[model samples]
Target: MKKHTIVALVQDRPGVLSRVIGLIRRRGFNIESLAVGHSETPGVSRMTIVIEWEDVEQVVKQLYRLIEVLKVSDVTDDPVVEREMTLIKIHAPGPKRPEIVALSEVFDAKIIDVGANTMVIEMTGSPAKVQNFIDVIRPYGIKEMMRTGRIAMVRGVRGHNAEEFVENANGHAERVPVMN
Candidate 1:
């Protein structure tokens, strides 16, 4: 199977997320990472989804068919940028404090907080890079982890704007205006 990243714009209303997730589940596509946030438009949310699939084209078409989905694009085909944020808590004893601080500096991670025997670190980078950092600190005993998921956008062009979609006379397929 091949891995693909899909960026979708959808109505930012309640239950939209569940509907989108349900569609993926119904298709038996495993979502590796999903990030949802407000878009440039009000009442619209941009969702970045990463999944492993055998047929990406078919899945993208299906994703577009969802009612709440305003626009869907396979960002993997574009010169896009991606990033993920992670907060990790590690066991940092008095003796390990300096070592942990050095590791954090090496990885460009910030020490968010310091507890009696634990330190919280916040790191942001590409998924693989973040995983490498986690692996490097695994020996220190990770107590907890929280990730904000992956978010991406095309490098040059803004994707289809929701306001550009016009309902056809049949009210079925929305006509997307061409850009010149």
Candidate 2:
């Protein structure tokens, strides 16, 4: 199973995300990570999803079938920079606090919150780095942990222009222009 990252632009309406996730679930695609947020263009949203799939074309076609889906691009093969952020609250008191802070410095992570018994460390980097940091600090006893799904953008060339995404879908050009 190969991992694939797909970026999708969809109408910023209610129930859109749920429908996309439901479709993937129904198709038995293993979703590795999913992140959605408002895009530069108003009334449009960008979703970055990582899934384990052998047939990427099929997934793209299925996504295009949704009326709310404006554009879909398989960025997995593109030269893209991907990042994920994690916030981990670990047990750190007295001596342990210094040790945890020192370990975080190696990764350039910051101590966002400090308490008497725990401290929250924020780390942002590639998924591997974030996971490794968490693993190393696991022994310190994780009180709470949260991770934002990976977000990616291809290197070189603007992915969007004038609120328009021009891409060939199904042997024809699909130009989705988000209204201003």
Candidate 3:
């Protein structure tokens, strides 16, 4: 099983996300991580889903079966830029504060908040880097942690443009202009 990154554009409407997730679940594919938010297009949303699967092309086709799915692309093989953000609150007593601060600085992370007993470290980088930071700080006893799952975009001029084309009722591709 290889990790694949799938990027999708869908209508910004209620239940769209649920339906998309349901379809993938019903197909027996496990989602490793998912990040979704509003897109450059006003009424559309972009989703970055990571899954470990053998047949990713089938999954892309399945996503297009949904009317709300405007576009789906398996960018795992493409040159892409990916990132994840994490905020970690660790046990930082007075004696250990300097060590923790030094570690954060080494990772290029920010000391977002500092309290008497704990400090919050914020880091944004590739998923592997973020995970490495967590592992390094784990010994300090993590008080709390929150991570925004991986978000990815294909490199260069080609991009997921929702307005480029959409499947019409007859299953034919039709050009659609972006709506602001």
Best by TM-score: 3
Give the TM-scores of the predictions, in the order they appear.
0.88, 0.88, 0.90
Error of 3 at 96 (Å): 0.8
Error of 2 at 30 (Å): 2.6
What's the lDDT of the predicted structure labeled candidate 1?
A: 0.84
lDDT of 1 by residue, 44-101 (tens): 7889999987787887788778878888888787887789999999999999999999
Error of 2 at 60 (Å): 0.3
Predicted structure 2, TM vs. truth: 0.88
Model 1 TM-score is 0.88
lDDT of 2: 0.86
Clash list (residue pairs), candidate 3? none
The prediction achieving the highest lDDT against the true structure is 3
lDDT of 2 at 114: 86
- Alpha-carbon RMSD of each model: 4.1, 5.6, 4.7
CA lDDT scores, all candidates in order: 0.84, 0.86, 0.89
Q: Worst lDDT window (10 residues) for model 3?
A: 166-175
Tens-place lDDT per residue, model 2, 1-180, is 889999998877789999899889998877889999977766678999999999889989999999989888999888889999999989998888878989999998999988889899999999989999999999999999999999988788856322564334443225565676
List model 3 lDDT by residue over 1-180, tens digit each: 999999998877789999999988997878999999977666678999999989989989989999888889999999999999999999999999899999999999999999989999999999999999999999999999999999998888887666575556754445577676
